[model samples]
Target: MSTHVEGSTDLKYVSDEAFIDTGVRKVVSKGNWQQQYMSLRSFPEGDRNCYKIGVTTGTKYLIRASFFYGNYDGEGMPPTFDLYLGASLWDSVKTSSSSDFTIDPEIIHVPQKNHIHICLVKTSHGIPFISAIELRPLDNSTYQAQTGSLALLDRLDTGVSTWTR
Candidate 1:
């Protein structure tokens, strides 16, 4: 079953031992961005922040995290940070334009354990925040290559043809 965990909503999957900030905002413009979001309870305090979500073991899922910096702090400055899946690095949440909503997607990943950890690490620039977290179950055929011990392949071309000399 697919799960859409709104950052504003509380759940049993989230670790209670730790603290995370949750609040709602009045979004002037509406379309893709959600009006409410959950942010890190504290900023630049911990070395790493994690969200432990329970799931069925051996299940393949596509996880996505979204962020909308609506000036929750009223400072008009959005923070940039790093996001993590388990012990591996997933992606960096860079809030370039506070008005633009940012979404990060992770391909098929089969968790051997019953739970997966989603983490946010504070960057030198600003704090970390999350607007929402979504998970969707994927069929075996979705990403067969990732079901095994293999990892995603990233290719980069630095040739003059592809890059500036």
Candidate 2:
């Protein structure tokens, strides 16, 4: 099977500014021109994260990412992050506020230039913390998903992880 993904910087427009980013923990620099993977400001007690990213429009686009988050004082996924694509935040999974997710393998089709904008928004009692995020073109791993628990798939499930006490 073949998949279309947005790979490396072909025609990049990012910046060259790096910041301490008190909210996300690790240090990060703007991608290029107006493009960046930024962690804006912190919440309050430090329980969430936020970011801003931009892309040129009119091209078929696909991005793959893995988010690594830190833990808090038994509150949950430590620093809970709210993800926003442009101004519209995605109300998917979790509490619509906090989620620690693996790459869900999603592809976004672009219809125009300077048309797509993504914001990684976080909301918590404080600022959220993140290690690193890998956003690039989709690869073979994205198209190949292990279904129904294949022997090669290294995963385990309780089969009833949602059982109530």
Candidate 3:
């Protein structure tokens, strides 16, 4: 299930209400260009909250998680938390205090099981929250990792704009 439900014609989003029994849905105080970033799900009570996604075993997929803190809680401080792929530690989500700055962490993984769990662990620094999560299927031959999953470090878009081109 997805935390946010807005989608374009090419994509469709479903609610996470049925998949998760915790967290509160909130809208960001500041406006965002993307509709999905306007709303988020925050976990306050639980030490860890997870969203389970079903996938074909051995299929390669790109999993991305987005976090945008538009000061939704009225507090100016942005929280730092841990993100987990199943039981393994994926990465740390360090959010900027700037309302416009969005942190997106992506990973290319092939799950051995039928379901993959994307979990958010609360750190003492702040509460854990998530803006969006997306999974894109990839060809088995693409993004071949030597040993384990590949975590995205940086992505550069070098294509020229229409006017420049």
What are the candidates' C-alpha RMSDs?
Answer: 8.4, 12.8, 2.6
- Candidate 1 wrong stretches, greater than 4 Å: 1-32, 35-44, 146-165
Estimate the TM-score for candidate 1.
0.65
Compared with the true structure, the alpha-carbon lDDT of candidate 2 equals 0.35
Instruction: Rank all candidate structures by their TM-score, best first, as comma-separated numbers.
Output: 3, 1, 2
**Which candidate achieves the best TM-score against the true structure?**
3
* Residue clash pairs of candidate 3: none
Show how many residue pairs clash in every candidate, following the order shown: 1, 21, 0
CA shift of 85, model 3, Å: 0.3
Weakest 10 consecutive residues of candidate 3 by summed lDDT: 2-11
Candidate order by lDDT, highest to lowest?
Answer: 3, 1, 2
Q: Report the C-alpha lDDT of model 2 over 13-62, residue by residue, as the tens digit.
A: 22212322434234333233112223222334433233444445433345
Whole-model alpha-carbon lDDT for candidate 3: 0.87
Q: Give all TM-scores, in the order shown.
A: 0.65, 0.39, 0.88
* Model 3 lDDT per residue over 52-156, tens place: 888899999999899999999998889999999999999999998886799999999999999999999998789999988888899999998888899998999
Q: Give the TM-score of candidate 2.
A: 0.39
Query: lDDT of all predictions, in order shown?
Result: 0.61, 0.35, 0.87
